[model samples]
Target: MTDEKNMNHNNEEIIEKAKKFFREIIAENHVKNTEKLENIKEFKVNPFTHKYLANFLTGNDDPKSLAKALIYPRVLGTSITTSFGQNLQTFVNTTLEGYGSTTTGMDIEFIDKLDGRKKYCQIKAGPQTINKDDVTTIRNHFRDVINLGRTNGIPIANMDCVVGVFYGTYNDLSAFYKNLAEDYTVLAGKDFWYHLTGDEDFYNKLTDAIGEIANEFDGTELLEKTINQLAMQLQQVDGIDE
Candidate 1:
């Protein structure tokens, strides 16, 4: 009975640590995103533009969205920099890291131990992005890793590469990758999520959590402020100076 209690206590402690670390990661990214929004140059109401004000007055969903829509540069810049696909990868990486796994670098290398053997994973957004160049790079990287292992007398079979993708299938990949895909353990979509969490619904829960975090930074308040400022510019157009 005492041993079972101790095991439960350990599990609880691990759960708490995971929650704290995950929250901190989200909070840190939120701060950075807020800073980016704040640093964008103040929105100026162009006198010649008539649609912007109208959109602000009666836009789809709410005035807040219209106000946000008017900041064309900010919208485009954030989309380009923090793309949805990239954000999804960030969610996956941070979640894994919170669970005490080591996530590293561009391709999101997740190093883990499986059946007393080391497994090296590379996660990609989709197979569509996997071109000949990517295959060559992966091949060379594994070659170097194998050579290093052999030099140290550690047997490494192709570096035990595993590729996990958020989307896309073998059909989506080009011909070269299709053939090479057989050499690696390729996990797609739910299979990838299942491999990570042992639950196929894990990705659904992750996406829901991501959506909630996204709502917090939708820039609603900032949009309202911009609309108010633009209203002041509208007054100027009406020959009223404030």
Candidate 2:
């Protein structure tokens, strides 16, 4: 009888340790801070916009978070943006309204290798009067979008092909583009986007990736329950000693 009781005590102590470890990990990671409650007031004014806002802010329910987490780190370190980056940006902006900026600072160029001609797929973020904060927000929003894309199985290495446009002198633009180009292959035409649209394979891969991420988020509740149970078991063990 004493042996059995000792074994139970040991088990309980182990569970307590586990609970403490998890609590510390969660706290240090700021996992609960996934959403900013104060910002909710501004977000709630537009219900439709708010819905998308939740996805970006709350990593638990946001499929985009998974995608972004997977892709952003790979590309951010590099000076060049890839095809995957462009497509991912398009996907995020379209899905989440008001997520991107309205600055016409960046332009997309399409080059035709055969004809030695260039066509433009110009996307104006918004207007010339757009503020720096808005631009930063827009950039960060896209970065999150890229993260979402990664969670969806879009590889960051494939981001080569997209170009950044800036409003400045030729030297500035050229220098920026040249630096970026050194690290990535620019898409010659808008054909890549069209190809992406028509590619059922890519869609299937994205769907599967998103589903996997959703499943992981859903598991968090179960994880919490398990933690609570373990803590209770530990408390019981400590009581028996008293």
Candidate 3:
């Protein structure tokens, strides 16, 4: 138990690098995105949608204030997560033992050298992250890749494609997951991490590392300041209350 515990703690080389990268990425997102909020030229209001939701949702609170609250953080959160997701792919490619970036979202470009067969992967953050349209788009992407490979003398039978979800259980996933699984490999959480690193416990270890690193960053001031900044901007918007 002690040696096992030590191994987990000592797995910090990658974890530590992940920690540094994660912090830098998050902090950079905060500084860069928050400034963009300050330079906002306008806030477009969908009068009908914004009006009804604000009245019913906030129990008659000022809709304009509500709009500011919604717009800033929602946009910021989406921007951060989307960019963070991109960085995550780079992180995995660089930090993991046998992964690297790909031209067409391939799982292991290196796999072809080993078995003379190519493997491609389209990765998502979670099972619920994809929708019906996304599935169709992914299917199209796969088709295009396979066609391109065929032109290069690679047969279809030698190509494998995967939809890899970083976290979730397959049995508990959505119809979208099932749809993808109908035609390609779908791995989630433990299965996904295991597929990449061949260690079933990697997901747990990864979460543990993330949890520890997360505790080091305190965002109290940032959050409060952002809300204030956004709230102030509402005053400048023309006809926001209407």
Between candidates 1 and 3, the one scoring higher on lDDT is 3
Q: Higher TM-score: candidate 1 or 2?
A: 1
lDDT of each: 0.52, 0.34, 0.63
TM-score of each: 0.52, 0.21, 0.64
Model 1 spans > 4 angstroms off? 1-68, 72-94, 98-117, 125-135, 152-155, 166-182, 212-219, 227-242
Tell me the TM-score of model 1: 0.52
The lDDT of model 1 is: 0.52
Q: What is the C-alpha RMSD of each candidate to the true structure, in Å?
A: 7.3, 23.1, 5.8
Query: Highest lDDT among the candidates is held by which one?
Result: 3
The TM-score ranking, best first, is: 3, 1, 2
Q: Candidate 2 at residue 92, lDDT?
A: 33
lDDT of 1 by residue, 32-69 (tens): 44434432234444535435554654664243343445
Per residue, candidate 3 scores C-alpha lDDT tens digits across 1-242 of 99556545545555676666666775567556655554334345555566566566556537344554455545557766776676766666655434453556454442332244446777677667888998898888778777887898866541367777878899867898888788876778888666654446877987787767657756566655655665666556655533
Candidate 3 wrong stretches, greater than 4 Å: 1-14, 39-43, 47-68, 71-77, 101-105, 109-120, 130-160, 171-174, 236-238
Candidate No. with top TM-score: 3
Which ranking of candidates, highest lDDT first? 3, 1, 2
